[model samples]
Target: MILDILMTFGSARKNEDDCQFNGYLEDYLQLLDNREEHLQVLFQKVVEKYPNARICVGLRFAINKEVVSNQIIGYKDAFKLEGKALIRSL
Candidate 1:
């Protein structure tokens, strides 16, 4: 079974956009903090459940640890970012 955790990242993006639209910079940053924590925990859970699970970093975020470089999944066609443009936009 293939598990797509990208949806979780998508939701966080949406939330950040909404917070920014409402002129809530603090709220957006706080949302990012929560998301970072969640992603860290989620990654741990995934690794525990699927010892050999493959993770695709479709979106970039900090998870406080190094992910196995060899397990990188490519999404060049789906996501194209120049430098830190995506993060700067947020």
Candidate 2:
């Protein structure tokens, strides 16, 4: 599993082409944010598509402490655990 995770990370490459397309660094930043959102939605879709296979979407979103707590431990999607519940909850 560590290898799988590492292999995924190893494949990441810089998207300098973003700067070329947007003509500014801010545009590149927006590209990164859009990419992040795409990844988030993709993970959610994957969980919906395959409920049996083990997977997780570990992401941190900025918000109030209450909201953080709710997403991090109060809901099933908190840790985005691979199964029906957070591993700790089980």
Candidate 3:
């Protein structure tokens, strides 16, 4: 769904000529950031049930490096994902 929304935004002819799409994308990312806490709860439950499971989560238009990097890295560490295993999961 996230990828589909990003692809739709990218493919729209209006977005090519208008800079407003950038703002829309930024807003969308912000919405994701806001909703992440609820997602984290679900993730924690899954990890608790499957202690050795490796998981990877990604966003299509993750423009904020600090937020995205911190979240993914946190997931990696908390989930005990390492090296080749992490890459393979991706």
Candidate 4:
């Protein structure tokens, strides 16, 4: 099963006209920064509802008409830390 969470900051017409690409980029980055927390919550909820299923987290972003996407099946075993530490190390 595929689940998607879509977030829109402003009207497409206005965003296209005003070239609000930077603002949208900022918002997307913020979302990415909080992705781990979001993923953890989603994993816990999904496991509760579908006990035997596997989980994967996908991330996507569009900026100035360019799109980028990636998926993570599971985290690395060596990465014992999270949040700011993980971000700072990278």
Task: Give the TM-scores of the predictions, in the order they appear.
Answer: 0.27, 0.21, 0.26, 0.23
Off by over 4 Å in 2: 1-35, 56-90
Cα error, residue 24 of model 2, in Å, equals 37
Give per-residue CA lDDT, model 2, range 5-77, as digits (tens). Answer: 4223211123421112312223323344654876556545655665443322221122333545543565534
| Cα lDDT computed for each candidate against the true fold | 0.40, 0.36, 0.38, 0.34
**lDDT, model 2, position 11:** 12
Candidate 3 residue 13 C-alpha distance from true site, Å: 34
lDDT for model 4: 0.34
Ranking by TM-score: 1, 3, 4, 2
lDDT preference between candidates 1 and 4, better one: 1
- Model 3, which residues run further than 4 Å from truth? 1-35, 59-90
Residue ranges of candidate 4 with Cα displaced over 4 Å: 1-35, 56-90
TM-score of candidate 2 to 2 decimals? 0.21
Question: By the lDDT metric, which is better: model 1 or model 2?
Answer: 1
Who wins the lDDT comparison? Answer: 1
Please estimate how well model 1 matches the true structure, expressed as its whole-model Cα lDDT: 0.40
lDDT of 3 by residue, 2-74 (tens): 5444344331224342112322322333334555777556655665676544322221232333455664655
